[model samples]
Target: MKMDYVSSGIGKTDFLQLRKLYPLFVFSRVSWENRLDHLYIEYEFWTGKNSRNALFFRPSLKVYGRPIEKGSAEWLDPFLFQLGLIELISYWKATCSPEILIQAGSLAASQIKWWQKLYLKGLGEFFFRNGIERDYPGILHIECDSAKQFRPVEIFSLQGNLIPVGGGKDSFLTLEWMKEEKENNLCFLLNPIKAQWDTLRYFSYPLDQVIVVERQIDSLLLGLNKKGFLNGHTPFSALLAFLGTMLMALYKIKNYVASQESSANHPTVPSESINHQYSKSYEFERDFQKFLADSLCPSFSYFSLLRPLSEIQIARLISEIPGALSVFQSCNKNRHCGGWCGHCAKCLFSFLIFRPFVEAQKISGIFGSDLLEKQSLFSLFLSLCGKAEQRPFECLGTEEESLAAASLLWHKAKATGKKPPVLIEKLFSQYPHLLMTRNAIQATYDLVNTEHSLPKKFLSLLQKNVIKKALFDD
Candidate 1:
């Protein structure tokens, strides 16, 4: 928990040491350093930690040997370190037998850790052999901060704060909150393969000021004989802040903010993400916020602007906010296509939660179309119904909210006399696990009033109610 850089130089700040400790690193660099802003961020990685030697599943990793610069060393260093984990672990599974990687944080992170070895092994086999590569490249190209391509973090930090932007409802909500809160120290992120920038022109013009985390990590896997799918839901929230710390310290920024929702604090699915929201929960905001203060910077503070809200709550808020919707991005299947691949959980959940507020034109723009087919909605339905190793907790929503959205969609479907969402139909036909989820969602959601958004503070207060609902529902 406590790391002393001087005594544990190699343990705390040595890149070469970490690389040697883990090893599969092939390439690395500082992709964007906005000198004017004093933000320096490195795009780097780590080797395999081999925590799975005792199990049949092994996770291989790939990452850069450095950091990406957006602000200062204070802001950039830990940000890069955090980025390295998410970037490398994808390759880690591709190279090893790490099916269901427990990323120590993230919804998926929590679920995988609790699953049996047999389940993990099964997922590993299905993934590496099949290699289901999915990426939502809708936000990577927005113009970067107004500075040279490779500005140092020392400079970027002085320019502003590094904000790890998410292309989703949560972030869209945070942007408005932060803007309304009058915090100008902001820097945005554009991940590898995202198209959020092209769409930004549809909304605000100031987006060019955002700092991008251009990732080319896929190049490293070019020669590896093995392959595994990329894992999602790691503690990228905290990681980005650590990076902000490094870059800000090196360059001079003093604060960082993330868009993590308050609901993230509870398990993604009860018993699934229980203790691990720290990877993305408000718990991380609280803990890491203090960690940064005690061990690191006194002036530097890291917390989620959306920490008090739930994913559903944020989605609802984003619907009410105007320009924010135009620039937001969070689809995994199609980033460049200018449409939400209704199948991915992000699109599915967003469409469902906001169905009550946003109109067809607005919804169409969000997903690239007004027409959400039954199949798209069903994909999410199936996930929540329990199709894979984990349910789409992000999609599951609070019981009351979940039921509310389900009811709206349900009513709309019945009125049109359309077939039930695939998963629902399957359950009606007596599908095993499939039926259980349908019944659960129907019963569980009945009490949720999934209508309208709540103030961030109010949403936080409702978390206890959500937990009670999640546990009591079944």
Candidate 2:
């Protein structure tokens, strides 16, 4: 379809009216089906005039042996707009569409504010990476049918905790905590990969315990990217947040616990709002909770279980969980087959953080090779440590965490009168300031982050069940 609106650098006389001419995209329809005990969700999006696209479920959703009443789940009727809005942003931002027309469902005044914040701040990394300047077209003009509400389920009567897993150590640690309530702790995943399956199986969770959905993207959007329509990263976690709510309602689950951590708050670029993990940050979690409370069911709750902890702290906690050494995988590049390429930023960061908590041989064995011995990874390590020109755009812990891990490893080796790993020694030699004493090294391991949305009960659970005797208590 030809773009009817003026674009930047076009020197057109209609620049001022660009917002009006720009196509208004609407999330038009949401259809579903239950075949062979599987639920399938289909979405339709329209972009001004006659242009429209559709997305379907690649693999039908499975909620094994669970009772999901069609009428009760269909109450998701009103919230479909919330789910659609999240899905629409990915395609809308692709064209950098100036206006979004909502024809499918309603958005409250607070909903408008929440979405604007998500689109602008959540896409911070996308715009900066694509060289798109920050000029947000005003607040979304949300046009919907009417505000609708359905019968609310009793909040106290809800049964289980829906823990979303990504085959990472953070989720694994969350799993360990939720195990006390494991019978009532259900796992939620979108498009489960081999790594996810392996991790779940290693934890002895039966196939029936996990709920899986296959989210299909519109192929037309992929084609546009090939044809040079603007494209970059979309806030994927935001999409998951909405999809998670739908599944929670459908399956009659209450708590939506993701594994986002405190380290995600750091900006990817210095002095800028471009954080790769913006959707996973504590700010987004807090905003999402408020929006859920205001606009959705009173029975539902959403928050990250690992919000108060750091990557290093989580790594230390994961070390205590059995089978963690071999089953967990955090390398996004090789997540499909559960293999670590051992060259990417995620792999390097995981290697550094794990070094402080686990034995050298065990850590190397889990990764299938010693990452520290590979001199070729030095540059990648530097990128993670903030020595390079840019922070790796991948999801990683803060640079301070990386430096602290290196410092601890070096000092620990010195205290034991043993030579440190090649990477640790090289890091210490190059940046002498990273060389710390045993006392300072211990301080780095204690990550007490106060900026989290975890409730008092959840915080108490972590302290009594996981933290007190886990890391520093030793």
Candidate 3:
């Protein structure tokens, strides 16, 4: 299962070495079948002539509630093939092969271009972290020689919505806003963690109403990462988008509702195109909608319900919903631990945003400690507030949002006649000019970015929820 021959930490030299060693990576084939409890999907990949270089990945979706009638292969093959295409990114990163031969299914020239863009932008963080310099036209070459072109399914009328939940504050707010439509909504979780399950329970959504996808990454890829082939962040949300399409078709759901906010549009590295949240950006959302309309099912709808709002607004809204706030968890580092890690950027950002609205003691309790008080997080705070050279490679709000949140917290602490946290004091002392005015902070809380794909009904629901919470002064 492990390759001991692979070298470790050669940087760009290693990248060049891997590509030279493994010139061509092939998507050999894909196979799937419906078992008694779940739909099993598998993909085979290999590089070079040695059979020892082959890699296999198997990811499954657990079938719950009603038994899914197996649709025709013609109707199902495209979805499964597309899923494999996205799933291959994990394995492909191990050795940045120059050419990818797709023998499993054929893709049109335009489809090939789409996948290329996804891979390039999706792997932006990967390339930057590994210090690999790659240009668009010269980076990768994807060729599909398979003569079989899977036909797109024309869906007539699919009802209700499929909401993907990650047990985060954004999705938690989305679930609360859609509570009236609970019966019509099908909640989805990929590899559910304890926090995710607890979030559903808090919302009173039973298991039968949830779609659980159990994805297993091949151990070979992990082994390669340890051997230092090449590894970093991939566009996981992109994979989720493809998987969402499959779920919609199988369950006959009309809309694919996600919880990505407008803040995701900001690039992690300023003055460049590299974004850690590229897949969740509005650009990706817009392109995906068009891809669905032109290439895939035209009737299906996909959009993030919270796209219009900023992270500050989401935090403020969640502060109003006490029960939902109690169960939500956003710390990626501590996701498996079912609590905040209190050290990562995600934890610090969550704490900074919620501190202005939630009671100080309660916020501290939720995160297990006051994150701003930790001197160890000062560097992360600077990066988040635009003081550092680059932002932390995480899904975070824009620099302006971070400053606004910090300003609000600082002003609140001053108003309450309490000592400000260590990080807050350091931030203000170092960069007093970055402090936001009251009017500016209020505008951020009330503002809504117009670049979203939400239909009128979804927009109406979002506005209604904002009004109901009454977080802002009207």
Candidate 4:
């Protein structure tokens, strides 16, 4: 009998049923080989003991402009093993199995707790969306059968910075800030897309200087998703953290500079911790740094370069860099199409953030239309402003930031003696109290959250280029 899982929706019953059917998910093995110019990795998993149905995934990475050296297996093995641990989450969510058996490597009690916290918090949105209530200390159990414990390697002689580019304004700004030392920095990209490449080209970075990792999902997992098995968002940035660490070790890079912003800390669901961008949050940044220091090399610096700035600040900075305005993109839905869809929450939020800084004509030209005039995106607008039940489950700024951007645009329109757009008019008419004053909006631009992991050198760089010049000078 074919189950109508979609119509019924996956709930506690479905969660329990799948767990009972597939009692155990095993992290069976991790194998990697350094080929001529690329390093190939394969991970194996099983639904249950003695089950013939096994899953295999192959993800390869290449570091150009350098020789491929198979680093010490002692350190490399653990890195690959940990990478498998994160990769398994995508497949494990299919059944939400009660226990995960680790046969490939071992973890200490503290390490087990660390992973549990990561999985639970990382999958918080997944549980909330599926209407599944998971309790702590018993939500998911991890058992390690192997006797081997991987220790941190004493690594030295690593130099240069590695920046992960996402083809967005944030990364573009990072590239701009690091332009002085661009030769020492390498752009890291996973599953290269046209937008990512476009951002690199706009920055005048050659392809040979980029580190590209090609990740492939197992077909069986997709088949399960199609068969109506439970599935939702996984912690992708968490996977990137591990993969970035592997590349750092493989290439002897000192820094893994990401472009995640402070706004990622806000939860999608207000008053709850179910953030779609949990892996990109500052909490994760701090936790991952500690884990790396404890389990890997302490000197391997991993931090977001734009951690201290807000989305509005990033947008303001990008607005000043006119060259990036055309090449960089943030709309996830329309990136492959090479333009803004202008309908999704991401597109709408981006438009709102940039509206105050860029001229109306230029904004319209970039997005192909005035997103503010689109009445269809009103609900998303309300959600982003915190008027709706929850913010759209996307990487967006806080509700206050959205309100500030909208308010700033509103005041600008009124001062210019021009009428506000449809959405803007609707916003003030319906919720007048939501409007913010110009001074209040400017406060967001000047504000800098003190909580960040940026080292002194990078912090000084941010202060000089962004804080002192970009935000205040304007």
Each candidate's clash count: 90, 0, 0, 0
Give one digit per residue, the lDDT tens place, for model 1 in 381-457.
Answer: 54543444555534235434544454445545556687644444443355432222334444533333333233354
Q: Which clashing pairs does model 4 show?
A: none
Q: Score each candidate by Cα lDDT.
A: 0.44, 0.72, 0.83, 0.83
True lDDT of residue 50, candidate 4: 48
- Deviation from native of the Cα of residue 109 in model 2, angstroms: 2.6
lDDT of candidate 1 vs native?
0.44
Full-model lDDT, candidate 3: 0.83
What is the C-alpha lDDT profile of model 2 across 223-318, one tens digit per residue? Answer: 655545556777888888877777777767778888898888888986777889999988888888777776767678888878877787777777
Off by over 4 Å in 2: 1-22, 48-65, 136-156, 467-474
Candidate 3 lDDT tens digits, 1-474: 112334555444377677777788888888877777877777788875454765454434444444563453347778878888888888888888899999998998898999898999999998887777647346699999789887667965588999988888888888889998999999888988998889899989977788888887777677767876778899999989999888888877899999999999988886668999999999999888887876678888999999999999888888878666679889999889788888999999989988888877889998888898999899999988999988889989998999989887777778779878889889999989998877788777788999998989999998877752333343
Regions of candidate 1 where Cα sits further than 4 Å from its true position: 1-162, 180-183, 192-195, 198-208, 225-234, 268-278, 323-327, 360-379, 385-390, 393-400, 408-474
Better of 1 and 4 by TM-score: 4
Q: Please give each candidate's TM-score.
A: 0.55, 0.87, 0.94, 0.94
Candidate 1 vs candidate 2, lDDT winner: 2
